[model samples]
Target: MSMLNEWQDYLPDFLDGLVVTLQLTGVSLLLGLPLGLGLALAMTARRPAIRWPATLLVEVGRGAPALVVLYFVYYGLPQLSLTWSSFACAAIALAFTTSAYTADIFRAGISSIPVGHREACQALGLSHAKELRLVVLPQAIRVVIPPLVGFCILLYQGTSLAFAVSVPELLSRAYSQASITYQFTATLTLAGLVYGAISLAAVALMRARWPRRTPTITAGATRPPEPPTRTHPSWETTSERRER
Candidate 1:
């Protein structure tokens, strides 16, 4: 009963924190996904100038730990006279990290297109942009969706890192409550439960396979009779002429 009561108090605050966490995730993805696609395109370009810079950015983003990046945005930027609110800083840092990682995923999707398809597009006299917009991207989008959803789940969990920068997300709320009530175990446990529940739900939903419909024949169903073929005048038999 005591634990239940503790959860009851924590639930409201934690729910509010969850909202912030979701918002941060949405903002990060909104900014990052398009940027990631652009980077992927640049990375695949034939020109070294275009590809090298994008490659460098992805390497740095993927090479560095997210916490370090978050710290850089929150603390280091102020030295350059660039200051943002904690939430903004967290969003920017996470977005950069997301773009870097997703760039590879996007590149993989793009590369999965068959060489024959591009050659066909070229033979059709289609411009490079048209080839991508009409033929390549449509297929690539489908391929990338499953992995993108997986990444989004990871990013949702990653939003917890924002708490380190005092962004008051779910984990931050849990820690704050723990500090005030000194119920570290209870608060932290509830927080973990909440995170686990959401993550598990997302995973379950993504893994669900919708039943596909197939043609079925009923007991009394029968195929319709074929139409009779008329004989051609030049090929009609003498017996048919006699009957006429």
Candidate 2:
């Protein structure tokens, strides 16, 4: 009844693969995050000079299939003089490619912010950058967090594609086990369970920790109660009282 026995026996080997999968996912996200944000900002730029090229890059990146991107990075890159290790190249390529996607995530988050927030900041005499860092970005980043975690889960799953390029991550590990044991179905089932568990864990953890608050609470627009008596001693009130 307990699956702990399998883990107890091969815990170290599984851990090694788990560590590689986590690294592949983490490095991609770390590299992609800033790049995505910068790209999102650039795409949203008012200047056509900035917007056009950035827009092009975002569009092209989004348009291309991730697996194709991986293939090009792995198989195509070395056709030139440049050479890269399998793990390094896969990480770099996935990072840069997914950065484009993450940029869109952030861009949407940033744009979802209201004009009034910026105006309010302006009224307070905060500069554009300060407003972004202080008022706008905080909210946008919050709005983006759930989805970004969702994307991280996605990136975690996508690490399986690293097998295409020969990175010994979960998928590659499973493939190795399959070749030796000829239990491809069982091995792949285990891989699927690992990926599912990771994604569900991400979702569950984010929900438990954050559990998105209602927009009204964060917006601070709740009205105060009216005074019980407008003014007991007011002339109008006194006149009405005298009449009564």
Candidate 3:
């Protein structure tokens, strides 16, 4: 009966917590996506100037613990005589960590574009920026979107770490509300459910954006298909015999 009463007190506090969680998640995506894509381009760069620095950043962030990064930003920044609020530090560190992983995803997507297409672009006399901006990246984006959205969902789950830095995000707020209302179990259980729902929704969104692999048929379906190249050798042989 007492626990049931405690559940009643949670509605308002949990809603407030959820708002902060969404805000942090939004800020992370806004900061991380473009930066991640740019870093991905950097990884593909042939120049040591760009490649080495991007490589170093991506490797270190991906290698390090997110929580440690959080702590470093939250606690270590103050030591250098630069002040940042805990929420700002948490958002920035989380965004940085997310960008590191996203860069690799972007790099893979961009590089997987067929070599022949790049040569085609060069043969057509397209400039580097023009080729990428108009042709290469647009194709790569279709391949990248699903995984990036999945990564963003992973990112959304990660926002819970913001609580460690004193951000009043869902998990942290649950802690406060539970502590005060003595409904720790109920409060946290609901919070867990909320996280699960958000993840499920994000996954569904990813699935909805799936790329179509094959081109749609036109009236050309009634036309004869081209003969295979293996059979074309006989035609070449016939041509040579006629010449002789």
TM-score of every candidate:
0.84, 0.82, 0.83
lDDT tens digits, residues 1-244, model 1? Answer: 8999999989999999999999999999999999999998999898999999999998888777788999999999999999999999999998998898788778877877766778889999999999999987887776666567667777888899999999999999999999999999999999989887887887678667422232232344242212111211222246633442
> What is candidate 3's local distance difference test score?
0.75
Best by TM-score: 1
Residue-wise lDDT of candidate 3 within 1-244, one digit each (tens)? 8656766777677788888888888887788778888898898887999999998998877877788888998888889986797778878887888778788778877776766667889999999888899887987776667667766766777888888888988999789887886777888888888887988887767667664344222353332212111111111235533432
Q: Provide the global lDDT of candidate 1 against the true structure.
A: 0.81
Better of 1 and 2 by lDDT: 1
Off by over 4 Å in 1: 209-244
Order of candidate numbers by lDDT, starting with the best: 1, 3, 2
Better of 1 and 3 by lDDT: 1
Error of 2 at 185 (Å): 1.7
* TM match of model 3 to true structure: 0.83
Candidate 1 residue-pair clash tally: 0
* Residue-by-residue lDDT tens digits, candidate 2, 58-169: 7767666677777888888889866788888888877876777777778877777776777789999998789888987887786677667766776787787788888888
